[model samples]
Target: MYSVARPCEVRWVNLSQVVGLSTLRSFLRMESHMSRCFAAILLVTTLVAVEVPAVPALPDAQVYAVGVIPDLRGMLQHTSQALGAAGKTLPPGMLEMGLGGMLGDPGLTKLGNGPILVAAGPGLLVPSWGAILPYADAEAVIAAVSGAGLLAEAAPGGVAIGSAPDGPGLAKRMLPALDAVRAGMPADSDLRVVVGLDRLSQAYLPMAIAAMQGAASAPGLPAEAAGQRKLMLGMVAMLRTFAAQAGALRCDLTVSASGWKIDAVQALRPGVLADAIRPQAPSTDRPAERLGAGDGPAVVQMHGCMPPRIYEAMATLLQETRRDPAAAALIDESMVAMVRDCAGALTGSFAMRQGFAGSPMRQLGVAMVRDQAKAKALLDGARNLFSMGVLADLMRGMGVEMVFEPAVRHAAGLPVDRISYRIDPAKLPPGQDAAMQAAMMPTQEMALAPTMWVWGSPSAEIDAALAGPRGAPRLAAEALGAGWDLYADLDMALQMKMQFALMAKQIPMFAGAFAEVPCGHPMRMAAALGEGRYRLVIEVPVEQVADFRNGFAGMQRGRHQPAEEPETPAAPVF
Candidate 1:
């Protein structure tokens, strides 16, 4: 019995061991299969990670921009140095500190500089906009943004901040557009903004048309409402044409120590407007050449040629006006003919300058004449028209009594037939009549020269023009040399001073405002037209920026001040 039990036990143990070994072998096979699957997944994820871009693609938008600053600290330093070279005074490292404070993160200087991507699209009420900013340390940027009370999210190689909550998703969508814009960006460009005019017009034009049509068709409109409606419709049609023909509007900005400069271009697609703007033969007669070099700096100056389309529009409006009884009575067919003739006589080029020298105010205008005889005839017709009883009554109705007369003057051995306007003191406000009369004694004077039409406030301005150039004007040479279609140089300080002085004479509260306001530097603008595009360049000086800041501060102070009681006039004598 013992031998039989031992043999049975041994057999049971051997069977159990064999079963256990079989189970262990099955488990090992299963583990090996799972390991193979894990390795395949690892390979796929590694490939995807390598393929993704550092910056996410930008989503479709109506507007997109990229601002590249390879070295933020270096740019700030260079700007500061340029400002110093341009004679602008600032405390050491003030610009950097100011920018850092504005962002609420001084450590921003440590971030790796990279291209910034921005995008915007139409929204229900406003526009939706977002930006993706590059960063070396995503954690630090996220922390800084959160500390500054802004929304932040981690991106592929940077941080995303935007108006929406899902900034990371937005960054991913913008990646493609960001890549495209970066590839096309000019090497020297610091900032470029692109506007999809077609998309914008599509989104906004319907609302605009509906609103305008509603207004135009409203009941109880004026007698001239029909003509006004036509004009409005015409404008809308033009805007539609512009949108259909224009690709995009691109504006580039470059900031340096000298000043801030912006260049905006609108490229036109093949269309009627493009054909109209095609380049023509250059004209030898430039209007800026006619302007006389003043003794001192000019308060304001402008030179440009009116496009043919403007004249056509004017003619159309005049025709519309003639159809209305009330309008026709005010602007008769004969008057329209005279205006047309005057416009026809002009070569389209014109220049104007206003200064405060040789008189309280010196103003001059020069228009190149295509037909001197026609211009002279129109001048006579204008004088007669102004002297007519109808025009006299019209002026009287507006509290202005104008006396028009013809006078002959000689300047630089040239006879000038001048038509001058004298204001009637009786029509002016009491106690201010004499001052007003003094301010506007030689209100207007016009003369038809052999090659040009000259006009000015006082006779002295005409004399200066007839005497020829005293010295080179400030911006005339530069504008003409560059063949700019439009140019303007305005001394904001002088203009404001003149305006304030005039206003103070009538309004006592404005007496010391001019003195308190800081002086601004001259602001210059230059524009040119190409075959299928338009270019505009603007330069805003640092002094002008300071002036604007100070002006706003003054306005804020005035807003908080207590209101003063309105002065009661003395009882009128019986």
Candidate 2:
């Protein structure tokens, strides 16, 4: 989170009302019948006790099934055929969309008359529903999607788990939320509101890659052709499944006088959320034998199994993914000469420090001794037999996409988005305050601004330190390690969110309001984020106060209405 030097008092004055309401609502909801009426009286008294300011409701939203179709090309082709003669004249770029593709064909205006799914015009397709990561481009996407008012407006893009607290009893928080909007709803509202979630299998990625590999190695198929047909189909399946899950998925939304006020049950899409919860992967994949014999999930407790061989393999795999301008030239160099000059040094230079053992080294060595002979063998039986087709098939079974998009959205029984925080200022570890101070410190002299944001891509880097190595009972262990009876990162996000919620009180501006300007310079963005190991923080700019109010108001009411002003006839001026 970024820090700014704003008056703490200024922030507080803006937040009193929200805290008052939350506190009041908490105190008034009594379970026993005898105190029910008394609870109501307390509610009114509580409301009367503090400043009752109207704060805009933030967009606590999760639109379940916004499907993205795979292969925008397919979409384009379908769209093109629909557009008679103009299809032939279409520029290739017309088919490649960034945010939303701009099809030169006027007929393709509306995104298919069907459902919601995530797909790409090309290969950067996101799975059905998940989270969009990294803040720059991610922030832009979130701003646009939320701005379009899918379900709700956003309080800065912080990670949060919107689930009821777990224990031997009811989570005390939900009671207040239920009470806050329940009375304003109808009896049938229960049916309208439902909680729904979708999670992708962990194998989604590996299998996707396998499919692409299979296609690429197919007999008589061009590279693009193979990718276009086989891999594209797999992507479609992913989108279809994601959307299908979302379409059928039910989320508990409170039917409000405004619209659906969703109380999202926050969890994470499989790969991501589970990563923080489960044991972390060893930095280096060792031999299976290294892990030795142990119990629990498939992850190795034995330790020796995933020796440096896996890391060695991965380093070569990394090289395969790299495309240097000089690759073809280097490949054309006489194999023997190249090896003497290049082979020995390159392996030594790479990270991971592994010697030539993976495919690249093996291939390079083969090229050196008998270049044409090795080439003939690769082209003849050896390569064709366990062909690239074999690998593609493997990836298909694994659900891996050949083209990688760093971040995409998905739904996995958890929240694609979330918020958390710490309220009891004293509960913070001694050094934490210093960390928070550093995070909150402003990057520049725009110190006049009240908000500070560690405003770049917000993400969670889970280490085994949080979730003990493989099946260590993460949450409990983390709590113990942290010297607390209990603790969770999401819980921390929640606490911070609550603090913001509190600030949103007297400072109506704070309610679901946040602005994070990525460092004063984009180059410094990474440096800024790395400065504090911040969970989440968003500062509200006082100058743009009106826009914030209007945005929040729209969320609370489900739509924004232009403020009204008295009208005077223009006839007087005439």
Candidate 3:
């Protein structure tokens, strides 16, 4: 068996395998059992040894941060022991048929797990994680084992997992990067992320600029290309200045069921664009009450800010980007138009839910739009470019006719889930009855008119469908479980691979040399600030956290391909 020079290491004989394989064989053959007595006579016993290491705790942050402490050695040892014990009891002919070879060299399994430690700050201002594998130390042991021919019988080539050249030098290079992440970080910060930002702006940014400049200066370029190039150059300049001002950054976030908000603070010095879009006092507006016919819409209604705060912030940013008088004038005109026509003070959603209770009958009411007159005026004025009289007449027709009540209860014996669809008329100012008739005409299953009385119980045809498919409920439960698992696996794989790919591009050699990459489990929630480190706290939904033991067992079973049964021994040649 291969052995490393760990003086204080303890070796554990898998007791179950020893009894099931070795003792079972001994009991079957008297001579073999006697041979073991000779082996015991020749053997020399030594003192037992034990090695243990301390486990580190995670950092304390004000908000929320996930901590990861991976014990690579322990994991490898446990996995190897399990595999070794399971491999010992193969049938007589199976070992000769390369089944033993497929199990791998249990004797040569002397590798230790490389542990990783990660500490994060609240909301991911700066977080650092690092691992150092003792690869250089393993080379010495490998050389010794080969010279002594220890593993020649066990595994001719020996197990060469994660064998890399210049292991010490590569590790030396990486350790500095780990240290650098913490060096300049604020001691006050619970977590810190130190990036090679000078390289990003001063090096990569210039390279991009040069490439773009070459493209712009190329011959036979279109006339408008020059203007586009100039604009791009201006944008790049703004970015460079922005990067310079943002020397180091920190972020914090607040998350709730409603949504999430991120507040990022950057250490800044003055930049041209920064001055242009300096922060202003937040606006004060009484939260506008839901404005419309008071709960009169039949189906669904929603009211909120017409232009959200994010849109306003974007407009401000766009205005700052205008660097010339003509550009400023164009933006001003656009803003004026937006405020006058598009940017309504309040917006609402209204849908009239009208159907026969227990019948496939439905009627869509008018939009129940507030400020309908103002909307009519805007379109009416625009008709001069085309024709105003027709639109004005149609608007008048819409205002006069339809009225929906706030709430209408359905009759009993209806399915809980119901479908509703809108009726679109080809011609404007069509009568309500005409519109409703057109909507139901395609189906020809229900007879309904666009009248006040629409909601009712399900019709006989629909009632039969609701009562069908007894197995549907059970099938749905199974589907939901399977769907959740499939989606969770796919989501986890995709997200991790994407992040790894990004990391690999920057550090090719170190990342590309990995033997087997580990994909961590999915996170329920995560938040990020503009082009910065993703702040994630592990909040796995209870339903999604597969039981640790069961999941591991399932994975093991999944990976193992089933082999044919061993042939029975011949019946002593009859």
Which candidate leads the pack in TM-score? 1
Indicate whether candidate 2 or candidate 3 has the larger lDDT: 3
TM-score of each: 0.63, 0.17, 0.27
Query: Candidate 1's residue-wise lDDT over 1-574, tens digit each?
Result: 1111111131222322222223223322332222111111100000111111112122365343333344466557656765665555678778777766644456356555676666666555554566667776667666766776656777765777665554445555666665555554445556766666666667777787677667645666443233333434444443444456665676666667656676666666655555554333345555555575765557767766655443443444555656644444445555555555645666656677777753467777776787888767766655555556344444343233445545566666666654333434344333434333333324556666778777775777777766664542567324323545667776776666565555444443434444465453667776666665666667767666555455545444443344433233232110
Model 2 worst lDDT run, 10 consecutive residues: 521-530
In model 1, state the lDDT of residue 321: 52
Off by over 4 Å in 3: 1-111, 116-131, 136-199, 222-320, 323-574
User: After superposing candidate 1, which stretches have Cα over 4 Å from the reference?
Assistant: 1-61, 64-104, 139-157, 165-174, 179-189, 197-247, 268-273, 286-289, 304-310, 313-343, 373-442, 467-472, 476-483, 506-521, 543-574
The alpha-carbon RMSD values of the candidates against the true structure, listed in the order shown, are 27.9, 29.9, 27.1
Per-prediction backbone clash count: 10, 94, 24
Q: Which model is ahead, 1 or 3, in terms of TM-score?
A: 1
lDDT (10s digit) by residue, model 2, range 1-574: 2222232322222122232222222321211111111111100000111111111121122222222222333445543333323113445435435434211223333333321121111112432222211122333344444454322111222211111111101111122232332233333323222222332223244455566445434565422233234333433333333332221122222222222222222232333112322111222221111111222111101111111222233233223322332222212222212213221211110000001111111000001112333322322221222123332232222221122121132222211221111122242322222233212211110000011000111221111111122322222112112211111111122223333443332233344432221111000000000111101111112212323333344334421222223222222110
lDDT of each: 0.53, 0.23, 0.27
Candidate 2 residue runs with Cα over 4 Å from true position: 7-101, 105-427, 430-548, 551-574
Tell me the deviation in Å of residue 170 in model 1: 5.9
CA lDDT of 332 in candidate 1? 51
